[model samples]
Target: MDDFLERTRQALAAQPFTQLLGATLERMDGEGVALALPLRDELKQQNGFAHGGVLSYLADNALTIAGAMGLGRAVLTSEFKINYLRPAVGATLVARATVIHAGRRQAVCRCDVFARDGHGEKIVATAQGTIAKVDELPAG
Candidate 1:
């Protein structure tokens, strides 16, 4: 793996929530990032579909990852909005994110969450987010 990709994988390994969700780094490079998650019963809702929170989580993390890659520094999501296009019922889910614009202090990113099943892939949600550089994290 390349330097950035290796570092990114390490960073992801440190995230407890990501581990909890069982998300995998499908792709990470200049083109952008693709995060994949296997759909398990624990991640579904009463309707037996992937919950909106799961989709939002994937979008939020993917946006930050894309932003950090574009900025060449660590970033935190400033804000994000997700629109659910349909119920996600599938064996796997993937969130693909790309940097739309990268500035000195921030980056705008777009992400699409798709669910994959025997039929194929279907976009279940779309999101856009602004990511800001973490110049310095405030002390707790």
Candidate 2:
């Protein structure tokens, strides 16, 4: 588990945008990956709710991580679709993702985004993503 956590940490560090979002890899297990991000004013939309892009970011990254967990290699989000079920109003956002299927070079994953508040967690969005395994990251 420690090795997996370290791998997750390294992977997160490689993504500047994910760092800007202040997302942290909370846990990774045989089932999937979990991530959390604090809700900050800067992350909110004009309506004072978490922006759709934020939720999409969370889902895409979480699902991509979940795919990589299954393959034990880096993965990229080839495509994803998200459905906003409700406004995200909370102190933090949580994303839980699991791989639905893993092929040799690609995986299908599902992620559920929840808004955590005093009342507890509520489903705000859900996503399905296709992640492709990458043997190595290309030099930028």
Instruction: Highest lDDT: give the candidate number.
Output: 1
lDDT of 2 by residue, 1-140 (tens): 67877978997898899889899987788878889999999999999999999999999989988988776666778999999999999999999999999989999999999999998999999999999988886776
lDDT of candidates 1 onward, in order: 0.92, 0.91
Clashes of 1: 0
Candidate 2 off by > 4 Å: none
Tell me each candidate's TM-score: 0.95, 0.94
Error of 2 at 50 (Å): 0.3
Candidate 1 residue runs with Cα over 4 Å from true position:
137-140
For candidate 2, the TM-score is: 0.94
Question: How many clashes in each candidate?
Answer: 0, 0
**Local distance difference test, candidate 2:** 0.91
- The residue pairs that clash in candidate 2, if any, are none
Q: Give the per-residue Cα lDDT of candidate 1 at 119.
A: 92
